[model samples]
Target: MKAKYLVLSFFFFTAGTLFSQNKSVPKSIIKQNASILKFYDKKELQSMQKGQLLVLYVERTKTLIKTLPYIALASKPGVTMVDLGIPFTSENISLLDTQHDATDKFLDITTEFQKGMLPYSDKESLIKAILFYESVLKQMHELNEQE
Candidate 1:
């Protein structure tokens, strides 16, 4: 009986340890995160005019707004937006409409994102969409300072 109890305890402990291990983040997500960091450099964004950034932001946000629901539905649960190496948050998303005429569209994207939408089919596309959003926000801030 003592030997049987020891075996059972060992089995349970080993099983729990195996099951509780943290799953590794996918290589694609890591690569996408790196790409986003490189693409949205602060100096580069500061140099771009607000109009250019606005146009890019509006177009990419529109695409994300349209496709994010599908991506969210198809993706596994617990998948999240790749880290963009910036302070992207719900508040930042809400502020997207403050500088643009497409307020409704921006609001739509923010709502979808808040609802856990993943924004694109692949990591690369998602990275581009987020980078554009970040760049536009930076440019908008610069423009506001100038005004």
Candidate 2:
């Protein structure tokens, strides 16, 4: 009886330890974090080169924003990490859920100008888009200054 009790206790203790050690963050959060980091790469930000890099940045930003939902969904229970035997805490999952919603709002604001003035072929539309982007940059700069 004593030996059986010892074995049962040992099994329970090992299981508890394993379950408590699950600190894996969801893959969605990890993916977004990586893209955000790459989007803010120092070399790209610091480079003097203008037109090409600016276009590339805008495209990349749009793509990343579009991907947030899919990435966030990829971490559903029994989907990615859970299926692989890696576990994540509820706190981390909730944080990512909130962040993903915020990302949608950010994308809407960031693309407001483009969405308003789509199909920019004519000279006037082109000029308007340019002015819109300039205004956005000005506002962003002011916000940074305030911070």
Candidate 3:
């Protein structure tokens, strides 16, 4: 009878502790989302020249790569790309260094995002492409700043 009471008491204590813990999403995340939506509009992306878009993409990618380690450390445990609304998997994180190296090599030769080397012709597709990197960078910065 005493063991049964103890078990119930422990369970309630754990439940109360978990419930009382702060699990609210940070304010920075809300602000970041707003910033991304405002800045990465599809219409704006559509208006940009391919070369301009490419330069921005490459720059943002490089920034993201540099910021990623701090992001990883500062982020809460079990925070997945899905949690952040980033449409990437853990596997993609492993590939960023390789991608960064290639982009760095390309940038070394020329500062232009060449016309013939366009990643996407469709305006919507281009927005999506740029949106992902920009979103990650913005969100990570917000998260890091909060900590």
Candidate with the greatest TM-score versus the true structure: 3
- Candidate 2 TM-score to native: 0.30
Q: Write the per-residue lDDT of candidate 3 for residues 25-109, one digit (tens) a residue.
A: 2222121211222346667888888777776665655454444543544332344444566545445544543554564586455
Residue runs of model 1 more than 4 Å from their true location after superposition: 1-38, 74-147
The digit string of per-residue lDDT tens for model 2 on 29-103 reads 334332222223334344434444444445555554544354324322124445445456676577756776787
Instruction: Write the number of the candidate with greater lDDT, choosing between 2 and 3.
Output: 3
lDDT per residue, candidate 1, 1-147, as tens digits? Answer: 999999999999999988894433321211111111233555554566654444445454554433333232221122233343433455544343233336445666675663454432344444455586666434433442462
lDDT of 1: 0.44
In order, candidate lDDTs are: 0.44, 0.49, 0.55
Q: Which 10 successive residues of model 1 have the least lDDT summed?
A: 27-36
What is candidate 3's TM-score against the reference? 0.41
Highest lDDT model number: 3
Per-residue error for 28 in candidate 1, Å, reads: 21
In the order shown, what is each candidate's alpha-carbon RMSD? 15.1, 12.7, 16.3
Lowest lDDT sum, 10 consecutive residues, model 3, at 27-36
